[model samples]
Target: MEINMFFLVLLILIPTFVLIIQNKRPKSNLPPTPPSLPIIGHLHLLKEPLHKTLHNMSHNFGPVMLLRFGVRKVVVLTSPSAVEECFTKTNDVVVANRPQLMQAKHLNYNYTTMGAAPYGTLWHALRRVAATELLSATRLDTTTNLREHEVKLMCRQIYNDSSHKVNFKSWFRDLTNNITTMAIIGKRYYGDEINMGDLKEAVEFREMMEEFFIVMHTETLGDFIPVIRWIGFDGVEKKMIDLI
Candidate 1:
């Protein structure tokens, strides 16, 4: 009888203690957020064209608002003044680090590249190296001849196309592709080789570029939900692994 009574008293006391502690805990002093559901939070509230949805929400919720995406806390900032404050006044605090993107996690030399790296000594060193070695005045001067040659070829192609009523979009893409190829690999594969058809290499290159852009633009739920990242639900992690 005594044991049973003690057990009942313990259960009651535990819950009372828990409630007191929870009540004592300080609430976040952050800005208000829209109503959020449990577990998934505001995941289902998002609409097509995410930027438009965010803009509409900002209109109702004010320029600065907090949001819970999955288990992640997000701060949404709108209005030019708020943006100026973030970028100008609090630049170091606001933009101190880059998020770990799926591609960066796998393909970027363990996120060591300047574009993907967290802002610090390593990223600063990499940026300095790229600026000095790849983007120096001498490097640009060396590539000027290549650029001029590609531009002249583009002009010739345009002249030829004037009589044929060709597609301007295709012509422009081809011209840009030629310039990029020359800049990167020091070879212009514009027209054709002995085996390849006219501009077939450029066409293949453009197709590859389109595929890369599509992959990069895709949204992955794992980005918001830390738990789902381990499961690789969206295959973004797998894709990055394969690319690497």
Candidate 2:
């Protein structure tokens, strides 16, 4: 059949094209790469507690190695000297830009927020504002009493509820939020004394934050597996947009 002939020709041409392109690339002074498999490239070698794996690789290979995880290329450095060099004044400025991540695109206001943003005029301006107006040493010092007050309230709740199971993580997160809100706007959204309107807002805020972190931590398949992604597997994309 014609379809069989077409399939035969396609399979034969694809590898030939790949080989031709590989032969055309100029040689580079790249660092040694570990044995990697096609399409997954070193991903199969990764294990739980990723820092340990990187450490073992660096220990055997060298302090620095270029690695590819799925489709992303990463430079792993274990040497203190190499780290110092990378973050030195000149190199620091050169590499100050943040990488554009798929999750950040939705969660970080299109990478416009303070931490996710690329280094440029906008980032510099935001840094200046934070340094002068929000995170200055004087500003933090002025809020010491407020932070202590919030901590005492948290401790009081724990002390009163010592008989039952306690969600320490929730309590600590609320305590931190209360301190931040109190410092910025002189308001606390959590606690038994808050009105129903404020309580609703607090619940919504907590839900939003929980979903944000959950989605942010989970790796999207589209990010790693291009063929599946290109074929319109967009479940992660839809979930993120719906959550947003």
Candidate 3:
């Protein structure tokens, strides 16, 4: 009975001590932040339609606010003047790079791909190449007919349906995938690419695309709470690595 009481007291004391340590603020001339809970910081304050939640915070905590999501510190700006000032030539290097995420390691060829690469010489070169050759205005103009054909196919599919109810998101994604595939490579997964004999392959490709977006968009706890990664509790990150 005595041992049980001691254990209960220890459990209660440990959490209180941790919370007290986590809530300690440092001295800095920084923007104001909302009162955050220990460990999770301000994560609980977030809600759907994230933009509206952020705007509401701006009304309460001024235009520029410093927020913490688990261990990650974020600086949010609602005012146009603050945004413009931060993005000026002097602060270009500070805010130019994208945040490193689990998806970047898998889908982005271990962060070397143009979409996820850090803002540096490689990224600059990739943007220049894309602008000049791959995604140039001339290239897009030439593919206008191909894009139209994909849209027509989507329209025809919808028209053939007896009831208008359908997964509009899937149809839109298929249309987008068709355009991107046909533009970069002269091949497609839908429409002209598949016949009755290859229907299985087409179905497989569609399922794969769906799964890709599902995994990519899903949240990773390690992203916000860095310790989850160091302690090897990153199952989501592992799944992403295995996927690619």
Candidate 4:
């Protein structure tokens, strides 16, 4: 009877202790949040057509509401004025840092790429290089003929194939890929009539690019939840690491 009473008292005390600790903690100044579950927060409310769902939520929570996606806190700003405020001189530097995503770490050489890098000395240097060399007006004008030639080639190919059904989407994708690769590497990797000598290399490069796009865009659960990463519960994280 004494043992049974002791167990009953322990259970009662545990909840009371938790409640007391919670009541004593200081409340945060976060904006109004929708009701959330204990571990998952507001994840369950994220339905398909995410933009529409967020828009609807903004109606109730206001433009500057905060949300917890797994463990990460997100601030949703719907109004144009609120968005402008974040990019102003005062707030721009504060908000310029990109979230250190798993893909950026593995594929982008640990956020060293200009697109992935945080706004810092390295980014400034990269911007200077791009301005004077890669994207300068003189450099662009030099490449004008290359762009025109590629467009003419594509148009001729399309015209020749007018009798058959043409996939404009595939053609457009090829056109853009060829133009980008030519600009960056001095050779086009996509489309027919590629040099037979470089056919094997081109095929390999295309495969690599396709895989890169797939891995870059795919979401990993580890990005959102720390425990998922620590416990090795997210297989997508492993795939990302392997791809890199």
Candidate 5:
């Protein structure tokens, strides 16, 4: 009974001692942060419509606020001027690297894609190739005829369907998809031009794209908290691997 009481006291006192030490630690250089709970940090403070909540928090904490999303420390900049300064010519290079998310690692070829790559020689090469080969003035000029053809096709479709109710949203979406696909791959998959063989492939591609967006927006707890991922508590890593 005495040992049991001692253990209970130790358990209570240990966490209290740690909290006291943490509170006393120096943080003179860091931005203002709201009081956060242990383990979860500021996660409990967030609500639906996350952007609005953050904007509201800025009112009390100032434009530049430090927050912890689970175990990850995030510096929120609410003011446009503050954001612009953070991304200026001199600061852009320093902040070019993005957070290494789990989805990015598995789905983005181990972060080798231009958008996911860490700022380095590989990123520079990717940017150069995109500028010189994919998005050059000459490459854009070559797509002028393709854009006109797609627009004319869309107009004809609208005219043909004038007798019936037209879904402009869907038509515009298709037009945009067709234009982009034709520009990139010389094949358009979203319109009447698609054949039976291509139709199956196109359907699969569309489904894949929908799934990709769903995965991208998914809020996995493992992403912000390392132990959750290490213990496979969320199964997020498995889903990402399966997506790939």
Candidate 6:
């Protein structure tokens, strides 16, 4: 009975001692930050349109400001001089690896693509292949006729609709899409599938791509709390998979 009571007392005392020790530790050694609350950290202090908030904070904290988003520490570089230093002086060290994302993991052909690949032999090989096969002068020359034909078609469409007030935005988007499709797949897919819409399946796919980008660019707690990623708090991984 005594041993049981002692064990329970030790369990409670050990955690309390650790907490006291942690509290006594000097916070001056840590990086500067805006005052924040517990659990949520600086999250509540952030204003809407986070980029703007960061920009505002930079005026007080200098060009390089440290921000805590949830449990993560992020360094924001706001000045062009600082950005130039990162790109020119510390280019290799600064741009070492791409951040792993759910979409890249599940849908980027296992990260075999150049966009998602790390800076290594495989990435170099993919870059070389893309440069030679897709961006080469020979390839561009071969596709020149297709590009011209598509542009001519676009001109005709604009001429036919000259009298009407048309949406130049949609028209330009369709033209761009048509040109890309003809160049890449050797076919135009605009306005083909009825179920997809009067616009082609490719246009629908473009809309989906836009939505995926919007979500990825938005801030989320998982990005800050690494452990929360294990629980899949935002269903980010699943949404990424569905988008792909």
Best by lDDT: 5
Give me the runs in candidate 2 sitting further than 4 Å from their true place: 1-20, 137-148, 163-170, 182-193, 232-234
Q: lDDT of each prediction vs. the true structure?
A: 0.73, 0.80, 0.81, 0.84, 0.86, 0.71
TM-score result, candidate 5: 0.82
Residues 129-153, candidate 3: write the lDDT tens digits: 9898878899888999998988988
lDDT of 6 by residue, 93-126 (tens): 5666786655666657777789899889999899
What TM-score would candidate 1 get against the native?
Answer: 0.75
Q: Work out how many backbone clashes candidate 6 has.
A: 1
The TM-score that candidate 2 achieves is 0.79
**Which prediction has more favorable lDDT, 2 or 3?**
3
List the candidates ranked by TM-score, beginning with the highest.
4, 5, 2, 3, 1, 6
Model 1 whole-model lDDT (C-alpha atoms):
0.73
Off by over 4 Å in 1: 1-26, 163-176, 189-208
lDDT (Cα) of model 2: 0.80
- Rank by lDDT, descending? 5, 4, 3, 2, 1, 6
The runs of at least 3 residues in candidate 3 whose Cα sits more than 4 Å from the true structure, single-residue gaps closed, are 1-26, 141-145, 151-172, 184-186, 191-193, 230-234
Clashes of 2: 0
**Over the stretch 113-216, how does candidate 1's per-residue lDDT look in tens digits?**
88889988998899899889889998789878877877777777777768877776776776677777778865555543213543676676656666666666
Better of 1 and 3 by TM-score: 3
Worst 10 residues of 4 by lDDT: 14-23
**Backbone clash count for every predicted candidate, in the order shown:** 0, 0, 0, 0, 0, 1
The C-alpha RMSD of each candidate to the native structure, in angstroms, is 8.3, 3.9, 4.8, 6.2, 4.8, 6.6
Q: TM-score winner between 5 and 6, please give it.
A: 5
Two-way lDDT contest, 4 vs 6, winner: 4
The model with the greater TM-score, 3 or 5, is 5
Please provide, for model 5 over 9-125, each residue's C-alpha lDDT reduced to its tens digit, 9 standing for 90 to 100: 865875576588778988679999999976567999999899999999999999999998876889999999999998999898877898888888888899999989999999999
